[model samples]
Target: MGRRGEHSKSEIECMALEAAEAIIEGEGFDALSARKVASAIGYTVGSLYFVFRNLDELIQRINGRTLDQLYAGLIEALSDCRHPQQCIYALGGGYLAFAARHPHRWRMIFEQQPRDDNLSIEIYQEKMDRLYELMEIQLKALAACPEEEVFIATRALWSGLQGVASMTIGRKPDREEEQWAQKLSRHLIGHYLAGLGTTQFNSRVNQSVGRLIDCPK
Candidate 1:
C-alpha cells in the first residue's frame, strides 16, 4: 500500500475507476465494493469517498466510461464500410463484439441503477443519443424518410440488435456464440431494411397517385 498523499484527488479518482472496472471484469459486479476498490488502488475507503460521493457515484462513473468505450468501438466498426447499409451491419457487429468482450461491464450499464439524486438524466441521455445517432445517420441515408420515420427505424433496428446481444452473448462468449449473434443481427437488419424500402416506395407511389387524383381530369 502507498502513502495517503502520494496521489492527487484526480489521480485517485481515475485509479479507483480503473480498479473497479478490473474487479467487475474479472469477478463480476456483485463482487465490487468501495473497500475492494480502495484496496486495489492502495487508498483508504475515505479517500475514495473524497473523490466520489459514494459507491453509487462510482458505479455511475463506470457506466459513463463504458458508454464512451462502446461508442468508440461503434465508430471504429464504421470505418471499413462503404454504404450506409453496410455501415449498419458493421455497427451491429461492433456492438455484439463489444458486448461479448466485456459482458460484465456491458450488462452493468443496463442493470445497475444509481440511487443518488446527483445522477443527471441529461448526461445519461446525451451518452445514449450519441450511440443512437450513429444508426440514425445510416437509416436516414438508406431510407430517405421523414425525421419521425428515421427516429423510429433507428430505435427499432437497435432494439433488435440489443435483443440479439441479450439473448446470445454469454459471460464468456466463444467463437460459436459470437457467430450466432452476428448471424441473427444480420438477418434482422436485412429484413428490416427491406421492409423499410418497401414502405418508402409505397408511400411515394401513394403520394403520386393522390396528386393525379386531385389534378383536373
Candidate 2:
C-alpha cells in the first residue's frame, strides 16, 4: 500500500479529476467509478472522497471544465469574423465543431445534471449564461428589437442551433451527419435573419438569402 500522506489532498483531487475525465472520454460516463479512478491515479477510493464529496461532485467538476474549454473555443471562432451575422454563423459553426470533436463530453454538459442543487445553481447557470451572451450580443447588434425581443430572439436562434447539433452529431462521427448539420445551420440562420430584417428593424439582412440560395446541394 502507498503512504497516505505522500500526496497532498489538492494533488490527489487534481489527479482524480484528470483520471476520471480520461475514463469518461474514452468510455462514456457509465463506465466511470471511484474505484477505477482511484486505481488509475494510484490512490484509494477513500482518497477521492477526501477531495470530492462523491462521484456526483466529481462529474460536476468535469462538466465545469468542459464548459470552460467550450467557451474558449467559441471565443477563438469569433476572431476572424467582422460582421455581426458572420460572427453569429461562426459561433454556430464553432459550437458544432466542438460538439463533433468531443461528443461524449459535450453531451455530458447538457444531459447530466448535478445532484447538488447548490452546485447546479452556482456553476451551471453561470457558464450557460456566458454562452448565451455570445449569441445575444450578435442578435442585439443584428436586430434593433426591444431588450425583451432580443432575449427571445437569442433563445430561439440558439435553440435552433442546439437542435441542429443534437440531431446531427451522433455518438459516432458520420461525415454525412456533420455536413447536413452545417447545411441546416446556415440555412436556418439565413432565413431567420431575413425574416427579422423584414420587420423594418435596424438590422440589414445582407446577402444571407442569396448565399443560402447559392448553397451547394
Candidate 3:
C-alpha cells in the first residue's frame, strides 16, 4: 500500500487520473471503479476520495483531458491548410483520425453521461464550445452571413461530421474503419460545402429557415 505522506495531494490526484485513464483506455469505462483506480495507484480507496469527490468526478476529469488532446490534434491538423474549405476538411479528417486512434477515450467524452450533472455540464460545455468554435471560424470565412447564420452553419456542418464519426467508429478500431471514415467525411464535407456556396442563404433566408425548424443557437 502507498504511504500517506509518500505522495503529495496534488501528486495523488495526478496519479489517480493517470491510473484511471489507463483503466478506461485498456478495458473501457465499465471496468473503471474507485477501488480499481486506488489499487492501480497503490493507494487505499479512501485516498482516492481525498483526491476526487467520487468516480463521476474522476471520469469528468479524464474526459476533460481527452477533449484537450483532441483540440490540440485539430489545431495541428489545420496548421498547414491554406483555404477555409481545406481547413474544414482538415478538421473533419483530424477528428476522424483522433477518434480512430483513441476510440475508447474519445467515445467516453460523449457516450458516458456524468452522474454529477451540474458540474459536468458547466465544465464540459466550455470544452465542447471550443471545439465548435474552431469549426465556426472556418464556416464564417466560407459563408458571408450574419453572426447568427454563421453559428447555425457551424453547428450544421459539425453535426454531420459527428454523425460520420459515430457511424464509422464501431466497437473495435480497425485500419479499414479509419479509411472508411476519412472517405465518408471528405465526401460529406465536399457536398455540404458545395451546397453552402451554391445556396442563396442570407439573413432573411436564415430567419425563414430558423422559423421552420427549432435550431439551437
Off by over 4 Å in 2: 1-3, 201-217
Can you write out model 3's per-residue Cα lDDT over 33-120, one digit (the tens) per residue? Answer: 9999999888999988888888888889999999999999999999999988899999999999999888889889888878778978
User: C-alpha displacement of 57 in model 1, angstroms?
Assistant: 0.7
Clashes of each: 0, 0, 0
Residues 2-21 of candidate 2: C-alpha lDDT, one tens digit per residue: 54799888888888888988
lDDT of 2: 0.83
Q: Supply the TM-score for candidate 1.
A: 0.91
Error of 1 at 23 (Å): 0.4
TM-score of 2: 0.88
| Top-scoring candidate (lDDT) | 1
List, residue by residue over 89-208, the lDDT tens digit for candidate 1: 999999999999999999998889776545947347789999999999887666555677778878988999999999999888898999999999999998887776665556658765
The stretch of ten residues in a row with the least summed lDDT in candidate 3 is 208-217
* Per-model lDDT: 0.86, 0.83, 0.85
Clashing pairs in model 1, backbone N/Cα/C closer than 3 A? none
Ranking by TM-score: 1, 3, 2
